[model samples]
Target: MTIDSVRGAPEPELVQLLTPEGERVEHPDYPLDVTAEELRALYRDLVVVRRIDLEAVALTRQGELGIWASLLGQEAAQIGSGRALGEHDMVFPTYREHGVAWCRQVEPLNLLGLFRGVNHGGWDPAEHGFHLYTIVIGSQTLHATGYAMGMQRDGVLGTDRAGATIAYFGDGATSQGDVNEAFVFASVFNAPIVFFCQNNQWAISEPLERQTRIPLYKRAQGYGFPGVRVDGNDVLACLAVTRKALKDAREGQGPTLVEAFTYRMGAHTTTDDPTRYRLKAEEESWKLKDPIERVKAYLVRNQLADTSFLDEVDAEAKQVATALRKACLDLPDPRPLAMFEHVYAEPHPLMTEEQERFAAYLASFEEASA
Candidate 1:
């Protein structure tokens, strides 16, 4: 389907609270009551998250990271939804959600460790309420669904103290059977979970047309839940929509699908080349709708933040990037045998034998050197 066709007819118009020129607008269904201080904080979040993403991309090019999935244009989508989350809410993220990880108070170094080949996950998930990154496409959705069901069984639903779960995936994941199954389970059980799909225009090299003819959020209607498409570049809209969806889930209103309509400004990952499949014109058009630039413009136009504040934020971003670089380079590489250590909960004879043989092989190398 062409962009004009999708934007024109059967699908609903995108929900937006902030214009590309930085003017704030009102939404009847999704209202926001943000203070000036909170708005400034959101701007800080967008700046820092973008910096972290750019730094990771640079590090991957420098051979510090094996690969980096850059979330260049989706900062507002992530930060807005992430900040809407309550302290007890759980989040299951796909590998590219660096911005969400930041909002969860996860150290950038911990995330880098996974891509740097140091560990599967370097931090405790329970402590931060953020699960380990799932590289398998769409698998985390099922995990989030099951976790939400557990919360329901434990009588945690419909209470102020109750918490909901969020499943972060991409446009590509919506095509996966696992994600569809997750939707079925969540709907039938009336589970308190939010399915946040960041439709970044392209899923790898494939255009969104390859995924579905209809807008993705519309799929939720068939499964018996409400779905809304929001201007992912507009942080205010994303924040308002997500906060409302999450609140509904907490009140036992059931699952909601939040389609964050945004763009992927960079390649799918450090290794891929967008030039191979996408046009330069398309990229240029998105530059004008950049998430960070609009937020910065809004802050300046309203005098909520001055030049000195912006300069300070920029300096702070530089420090964060520098620290991330140092942490990535300083990480210790795991031993070859470390991979087999967690293969099973209890020791097995075959694994034991393999470990022994591997140890003997290393010993022989030392003996020869000596």
Candidate 2:
């Protein structure tokens, strides 16, 4: 398939609950039942998440952040799967899982602080059931697998209190040894984890064709587990598939690989330029499949949400974006010595010496200024 043809057709195996033109379709394998209220909530989530991402990208351009990984077009994939998680379910995320972070109720400013180089992800992971974002590619899958194994040992599997873990990674990560290793471990242990890969077509500057010879979901079969590809742009399909996968996992059905086939309409990150690699026409084609637009269209067409509600959502999104910007600006810079903290579980002489020396250095500057 050519670059422009990437979003042309959905494969026969692709599960899509809502079409791009605002039409709803049914999939017998992955049935979804959503109330009007739930639909409105999902629409709100899509808008607010996109707004957060837009604000972050603006902040990066304004030099408030060191850099940012924008989740421009993949909002549905994150929100859908994120909302699908049970209250007790755990998530191991990559750096770009901002939408998932939002769904987890993580402070947007906290995320900005990480990019702002203030403190190492200020929120407590145990409190949120969301692990710290992993910068190293595909390593979180291993961590999620091990955590799921621990859950199994804890004897929660197949119980009412059972919980599953979901590991979020990008398509590029599929090539990493860590990811493949994770697949092997999860399968062998029958770990209750969902390997959620958001295949956004472009892995940095390289295209999807360069990443794999077959659909990414097919790789799961080789690992002795089930794999399914879903329309990443369809929020309903993502929710249904993820919900079922998580439920099956809790029941000791082993791991499942869910490949959300989607597109990234923006640069890989604020630092990189997509124009250098992909064509503008390719991005334009994917615009027709915009995750948020489809949901809006469906809401409008079905009258589940009137214009007033749609307007209200837009206003709320703006409010969220404005608050995020203010919070980002108000974030305090960490003290020079604060870096010495959290280096290890226990204090070390080397750290103490370095801290003292750094303090002395700062004192010297003050002394000179005086």
Candidate 3:
């Protein structure tokens, strides 16, 4: 496939198997075969993550947290993409990927360390089979690329191992040189990685138009990969598309790009004033297509879940929020010496020297003040 420099000019082979109106649809290319239990788990994931996100935002507003990047409307995209990963697959995330982080078994409140200005990372990647959320935009792409390349070199991708790598980024990240470079690397080497772009239509105040004239997934042809767009608000569509993409990559079919077309229903961050840039009408529009509501409607229409289940879910949501609020408040700040770990694999000479200097300076302050 020759790369096209133009937008929306690429043929529409992308798959979307569900609609925002709580109805099942089909795409000839991507078929979904999931059980009821799977759907219920997906619903649970979306609910609990959204509740945690809402609590985090409230905490920020109430001064319980330093800041938060809420994943209000993008939970389906993140959780579905997360579910697509096999147990062996590894994940890399950006700072805003709390939804994905939650899916990977990392507690929601663990993310507060960085926002609270206490640490470089929230948790060890090895513990959760995920990398520390990188704050620098699009940087995780290279890490994912490198990891995939390593997997290829190990001959892992040559076999049907059900293992691959995934990197999550946002629409604004698509413009970064690192992202494009990652594409170049993945395409050239046929790396078994998925570049999952949550195109929630806004890169801060910048609209989707600012970054590309064409659809993001269509742009992947230039890099020698198939790209698909899903109804990110429809969790089932996200699951179907991402599962196929990861399967293709793991089967040595090379990389794929998934553009989860969703929306961000909140400010870019706790510090942001989105009202200053976007229209109130747009938020209202997306709210009507709420991911959680769509799923709830589907479950009720199909009798997969009843009002009692939903009420129970609602109660559980509140419990989750309360637990997260307490966790954020109770989390201890990082120890003074805990800062010296994880900057590098080997002992970093410069960091060691700085740590000593910092210790000396702190000691001098106490001596002088005393």
Candidate 4:
């Protein structure tokens, strides 16, 4: 069914705890008790994350990396939801979740390895409770649902210390078959997972209009679960909504769908030219709603941080970016033979034959030179 078919007369209101003007607001059901230091820390996180993205983009342009999928405007959505997780919680991420990876403490160099073509994935899932970036669109949703089912079977739900799984996808992924099937499975089994869809208003060249005429969250109602739309640019709102969803899942309340409504301030990837499909006016409009700027404004307005503190964060962010560039440049290229090494857990006759053939081909070139 089309999104317009399922949508109500009016789109559901977004859950917002902070306005674009940096004003603090309150929600009746979702309350946040953040200290001044914590607020400052969150602002730091946003700044560093954006710096990381900027450096990566520059690297791509300079031919140091193959390509980059920038999380330029969606930093709040990723960092906010990422920080809400418990130590044992698991996350399945889309390719652009650099901010979330940072919150999970995954090394920055590891992320660069993927774009640098040095490795398929750079970090262990178990080590950081973060899955490898999934480039196949909505595939991670199914993986997350299956994982949550395993958690339920293991009696890991309905406890104070219980953990939940979060599946991260894009607005475009909601149209995929895998995502819909995941919704069905999670709903039927009541899996303790959160489907976090970062609806950044564009599915590559396609706008939100191309995906659905209705708000994405409303689709969850038909699947026997509750869904809420949150202001993805508002870090506090994202954190609050995600925290509540995780708590409910841990308590055996089943799955939740969180549609984070935000905008992608950059092209789909380094290879894309957004000037073709989108407008200059549109880009300028979103600049006013910038995620990082709002947090910086709030910190300054509330006297939670000063020029010295903000400057310190800026300095720290620069160091991180510099270090990332060095690490990326220092990474050694993988040997050609390395491709066949990790294809299977156990060796197979066909693989052995292929490896031998490849080795003989390499030796032939050496022999000819001799």
Top candidate when judged by lDDT against the true structure = 2
How do the residues 1-370 of candidate 4 rate in per-residue lDDT, one tens digit apiece?
4344464565478899999999999999899999898888899999999999999999999999999999999999999999899987999999999999999999989999999999988799999999999999999999999999998888978765588999999999999999999999999999999999999989999988888877899899999999999999999999999999999998899999999999999999999999999999999999999988898889899888899999999999999999999989999999988989878999989999999999999999999999
The sequence of per-residue lDDT tens digits that candidate 2 reaches over residues 288-309 is 9999999999999888989899
Scored by CA lDDT, what does every candidate get? 0.93, 0.93, 0.85, 0.93
Best of the two (2, 4) by TM-score: 4
Ten residues in sequence with the least summed lDDT for candidate 1: 2-11
Query: Whose lDDT is higher: candidate 3's or candidate 4's?
Result: 4
Superposed by TM-score, candidate 3 places the C-alpha of residue 243 at a distance from the truth, in angstroms, of: 0.3
lDDT of 1 by residue, 1-370 (tens): 5743775765577899999999999999998999989998999999999999899999999898999999999999999999999987999999999999999999999988999988878878899999999999999999999999998888978776799999999999999999999999999999999999999989899899889878899999999999999999999999999999999998889999999999999999999999999999999999999998898898899989999999999999999999989878998989978978878999999999999999899899999999
Q: What is the lDDT of residue 111 in candidate 3?
A: 83
RMSD of each: 1.6, 2.4, 3.2, 2.0
lDDT of candidate 4 at residue 248, scale 0 to 100? 92
Give the Cα error of residue 175 in candidate 1, in Å.
Answer: 0.7
TM-scores of the candidates are 0.96, 0.96, 0.92, 0.97
* Candidate 3 local lDDT, 1-370, one digit each (tens): 2222354365544455556678878878778887777787888989988888888888889986787888989999998888877876889898888878887888776687567767676687877878987889999999999998888888877565657899999999999999999999999999999999999889999988888877888889988898988878888888888888888888889999999988999989999999999999989989988988888877888999988888888899899888777877777777776777777899888999999998887789899999
Better of 2 and 3 by TM-score: 2
Residue 275 error for model 2, in Å? 0.4
